[model samples]
Target: MTSEADLAWIASVVGDPARLRILLSLMDGRARTAKELAFLARIAAPTASGHLAKLLDSRLVAVEPQGRHRYFRIASPLVAQMVETMSAVAGDASPGDRRLRRIDPALAAARTCYDHLAGRLGVAIADALQARGHVAFGDGSGEVTASGRAFFAALGLDLAEAGHGRRVFCKPCLDWTERRHHIAGGLGAAFCGHCLSAGWIRRHRDSRAVEVSPEGRVALAELLGVDGQALTSGWPERAAA
Candidate 1:
């Protein structure tokens, strides 16, 4: 039930460059404080607050209060999907010649998709899951075969245990960098957890960039039946996270 007037107002709200940056910064689905978002968007706190207020009114963003801190995130998964899809398209369209630190050549290998794993590792795992016939669905409500469940269990990633009554399990998260799709949802988080615990990958010292090690290459091959090293060779090794 969206009124034309409301839509018009939202259009205005998202039209500003600063607000657009803020919205894009939150696409990874992580709740962020105004100051954090402001730093990411390179805007002032008051300005970020103003944009957040407008986004909140549009229902494009939601806020949570934690003691003295208030945090904001995209209003819903639908919003996250929309932002990711749009960012993917926009990033492709505007392949700037300038070399930015964030746009490293290795972005595809390991990076953050909001808060979870994304990039080449993300894309390949997503593709392999679908290719292996383990997942059969689009962005939500996927069905995983029993063998698929067992296969992951061998990797120390039991979906039942990893899922642990959280968000939807075995769902697809459309890739913003690859323009394809990646496994997301509870299952996705579980898989990510397994990778982390296995010493296969490590988050960059301070950045969202993820680096795969020699061990990760061996582990991903043994666990996922796909050679992580092979897939990332000459590919965008540094895909966004």
Candidate 2:
């Protein structure tokens, strides 16, 4: 059980602008060295190192030594979710707010929320799954139906293997940009992995935005009935719910 003191400690650890920048830089599920993180966070090497020590102490980030370099990454998926959720809360601008209109188009279209998908593309996939009775979301968790198992099996994804870990099997992650839920957890990781491996989606260099390939368009259209072109071209605006 996390006491109020524990919660406040964590909030303070993550509240620093430089530390939050470092955390966001690692949100793409990549481990980065201190030098690289300093560059990304736009802080001096010594300053970034100090911030990193605090993050390490808070257990919000982890370090792995590779060769002579120490790489830092968000400690776990739970940590990533917390950061994303906080972003959503902090980014709740009014509809007519200029900040809302200034969001990057590519990121708002499709991006990685840690290892899984987020943005319009992610939400579309979730909607398709629910509409087809492949998955169901209730409260904060989700479940795959029997047919959903078969559907994933057809795609060569082993749910048992994906779920065989300490991580949550499936859950809804609130997208900061979309202000809607996108699939997260083990199932979300597996699906995103399959897409990347199958050449359906390609991650941008040093960025979370992903581009759908020609093959991805066909695959998503046939499999999930998602219009990749519409997603890419910015059609299908967010309608009234």
Candidate 3:
């Protein structure tokens, strides 16, 4: 049985409204400075920090030091996976197929936290990979295809070199928004890094939402075989070039 102290630890952190907002903010899969998180959560800077501190203490979030800037992010993708999975079960759910319909709405577009996929970006990436034959879902897991090997090589990622054992290579994460599976695991982390390094995407102010550059669109298409122009018609023209 779970101990009361364990329950208390979780309760102390999660029962908070602002802290919860902070977690939601990080769902975009990008690292954010504390000031940006404060704005995103609509809390004062000090309050945001304190709440973030509590989350950090609980291992629900992590920090990155970039020169003078200190950025906060979800501690790990496991946190996102746990939160999303719990959300899927709805806590009050019964043992049945009724669980299939629950979906997080905002995730249908793009969102993430720290170093992993979240929201719509997560959902779409997973879909595109599967659709284009780079991946396939089976046997309670996913596998990278031969096509995926060439695909990653083009982006300059060699997952084989990223190391083996004690790390998941490819895994499906449930998208909170679209109620579908998206790619997670080591491969997902690598993809996010590639996007950032290539300047194909950027984070918005005070939100986990990602803005895909027009160039990013073209880059994604070139890299992942996605149709950049067709995928996002509303992206400004300059970025698309």
* TM-scores for every predicted model: 0.53, 0.57, 0.49
Residue 43, model 3, lDDT? 92
lDDT, candidate 2, 127-168, per-residue tens: 778878899987658999999999999999989998997999
Off by over 4 Å in 1: 1-102, 234-241
**After superposition, candidate 3 runs with Cα above 4 Å error:** 1-108, 163-165, 229-241
Q: Against the unseen true structure, what C-alpha lDDT does each candidate score?
A: 0.69, 0.81, 0.68
Specify the highest-lDDT model's number: 2
Query: Relative to the unseen true structure, what is the C-alpha lDDT of residue 230 in candidate 1, on a scale of 0 to 100?
Result: 52
* Per-residue error (Å), model 3, residue 7: 46
Cα RMSD to the true fold for all candidates: 11.1, 12.7, 15.6
Question: Candidate 3's C-alpha lDDT?
Answer: 0.68
lDDT of 3 by residue, 67-175 (tens): 7777777765457666666656667633322332333333335666556666655655666778778988764468899998888887799788553768787877654
Clash total of candidate 1: 13
